[model samples]
Target: MLPVTVEHAAQTPSIFLESAYFNFVLKAVYHATKTVLAFLQRDSVLYWPFLISTLAIAWLAWRVGSAAPDPGTKSSWRAFSRSHLSRELWWHPSARLDYRFYVINGVVFPLLAAPFLFGEQVVANILNSLSTTAPGLAAAGTSTGVVITLVFTVVFFVAYDLGRFLAHSLLHDVGILWEFHKVHHSAEVLTPMTTFRAHPVDLLVMAWGGALVTGLATWLFHRFVHSGITFYTFLGLHVMIWVFSLIGNLRHSQVWLSYGKTLNYWLISPAHHQLHHSAEPRHHGCNRGFELAIWDRMYGTLCVPTDVPGRLQFGLGDDTDGRWRSVGRLYLWPFRLLAKRVQGALQARRA
Candidate 1:
């Protein structure tokens, strides 16, 4: 239901990096230099930016949480409101149920996934190459290797996020995909807990797409640029996304403030993303940018209504099949819909 705009209206920034297939060797040099520099400096440069950004982001979270109106009471005359430390979140039966899954989907899955990605073979290949490459890269400088990895990681994240933003936008715009996406928007109230209340199938699809995009970016960056990989450096790719999620926990709270309404296009603000969660037709799929708003702006999916009342509701319309109201139902509903569709198609052809 996102507002349809003219094509080419969103002239997203053109990707300026050198060709992916041919730039592998130069990227290796960048990686080697960055790794050496990071080791020598103990990642001060890396951690400082993260620390400062975290603090600034934390302040932003507090501000936004304070702004959310109380949805429990009609007196507030606003929508999607909750306290930063809403007792209801910690004790709400629905919240608790959602938390169990969040832990598995967010923290546990990430930890379990590391081993698979950083398995023996993957590590061995990178380590073997690094032994020889690091020595030469070290000669360049103390933090040269670190610098290389840092730059590569940033670029990788940009590409990965770009892909995610575009794909998610498509999911909302495409009728077939919207059926599943609607499950996510079906939340009646906004809370930190609501952030993780996505259908498991939706989570799986998102996780897989993210992993695929990151992996492809990493492998291409390492093989062609730095000649190898450094796991932490590679991890730095999604560092912003992780931070965004950590901060995003605050976005749905009653507090609300937006810094980069225009600039944060690179890093989506809570206010910016909130609009997307709105069930209203115009708001739907509007703020499709995940970690960054740039893709939305560039692709014309950006929706910033400076004048409209805040999103009044956060779920699907009356047509929701109450059967999928529970956590288990949300997960299984997609498959059931698909099955019904397939059956209908087969019967129609036979008839």
Candidate 2:
């Protein structure tokens, strides 16, 4: 107590760190485990209900898929297993990258990327500050009326769908953004886990886009109508989104469940998404919408699927697909490509 010592001062930080490090590690592990466990819950695509729905749809697709016989329906179980479920396809080097991407994006990406994510509520609050509305109109904090709730539900759902589709199209059309999104399109084979195989940057962009549009819609509703309305939900999810989740898993699978020609014009089926994944020249940038076809149809990007299987091939269809077969490269290559583009631009400018 009488004399200040350097050893004592240095030891204080070490002692405090040693005391806290164990609990910090334990807390991190606990949260990560909890997040991974959510994969099995109803909110997730890997949930039993969704997976079972995919199976039922697949079986039905084989027995009776379209109004008429579909070429995809003629595909045998052996062909489906070989393409989608085989030891070769599932265990391929490219699919191994997807597995690693799934783990990283699921367990690690959310933690590191949370601070970068924009919340729709936050966006709405910002927009609300810029606009003036009658403050005394209805109770601002409380919700009322099932009809209003249902309408809000549909509106919010459409907002989300529009945002998602627009973001997806931009990722295809924009050169700079495509560098990051290319990680997803590089998958050679599709699986349930492939749905999770996205670069964290890709997820961040999509999240921000969704938040901005949905938040804009939220502000409009609050300004014109009342802030006392909320969307209807099913099991803690938007009713429309929960319904979409039933067949969502099949979108990245080998299963072909088309909504037929007529509905295909209005809706996007699993077949539509498979075409989106296809590396063919004509199929590139086609069917980018998640559920609705109107966005794609209006944009001239819609390609109504004909339910023919085995015609489409996946991946970038070039050397990059093989070169980025490792998960580490999948993460780093986008940055490297961006750097190269910057370097090239500078050199050209100097020349």
Candidate 3:
């Protein structure tokens, strides 16, 4: 104790360092395994894992409010109006309305746009250019491209979300674009699926607009800068897609998660998005970036007021309950607005 040897202390630190290194390796291996498991869960036989994870998340949410019967406060074992926070979209009364739009916007519009977006002539032109430059790429064959295309399809979905944010900001700020896109924000209820609950025409325009801009940008990036997409492009995109989906859902939830401005770059964080959906004019163009805050920052449309709470209401100025809120009405509302504008213009000319 009086004279501790350097060798004795060195032995402990060496052992401790070795132990820490082992723990780091173990954690790394565990995370790698988890990622692989997640990728595998997309297969047919892996449905059980997917189902289990979904149930687990649902159970986790339930557990937060699953208290035993209380003594004094009035409550019923057979509850009718459960807390809004506890209920999923399917259980919500207006959920069907939301899904109705989603089917039309996410599924229908995408399919409709595919012909125009990936037309044979367009495809041939694109492939011919790539084939001319990278002749070896053709040898990979249709199967390789098909497999690659399957992966790109997921990227396109992610890209659409990013596009929607920009398109949304434009809808509010730009004059004519708003005429077409206003139909999306016209919704009374904001839900996770609300992102997909867009007017078919608006959906088509925004999807194509963003796709065109993004595809061209990506082509330039791959063609000029990198000569091809980097692994990080795919990895970063995949990570951001999952993150945006998770955060986007919260933006729709009644309960708020305010990240202020710190994590806004990493996430389109729910709190800022809520500000965008606000009925307040000040928050009209807030949180414009879909996946990256950089877009909002670059365009100077980002809004995050420190003094006021992010919680705000949503509903287009012309909204009428059970009227223009239906899926059919959503599609027709723009046309009606257009017709009204035309009539007013004619009257003004006569006057």
- All candidates' lDDT scores? 0.55, 0.79, 0.53
- Report clash pairs, candidate 3: none
Going through the candidates in the order shown, the clash numbers are 34, 0, 0
Per-residue C-alpha lDDT of model 3 across residues 156-264, encoded as one tens digit per residue = 5445556666666667676556656666566555665565556666665665657655565444433433333322233334443443443345455443444555765
Global lDDT of model 1:
0.55
Provide the TM-score for each candidate, comma-separated. Answer: 0.60, 0.87, 0.59
Better of 1 and 3 by TM-score: 1
Lowest lDDT sum, 10 consecutive residues, model 2, at 65-74
What is the TM-score (0 to 1) of candidate 3? 0.59
Q: How far is candidate 2 from the true structure (C-alpha RMSD, Å)?
A: 3.8
**Model with the higher lDDT, candidate 2 or 3:** 2
Off by over 4 Å in 1: 1-97, 100-146, 173-178, 229-246, 264-266, 305-308, 321-323, 344-351
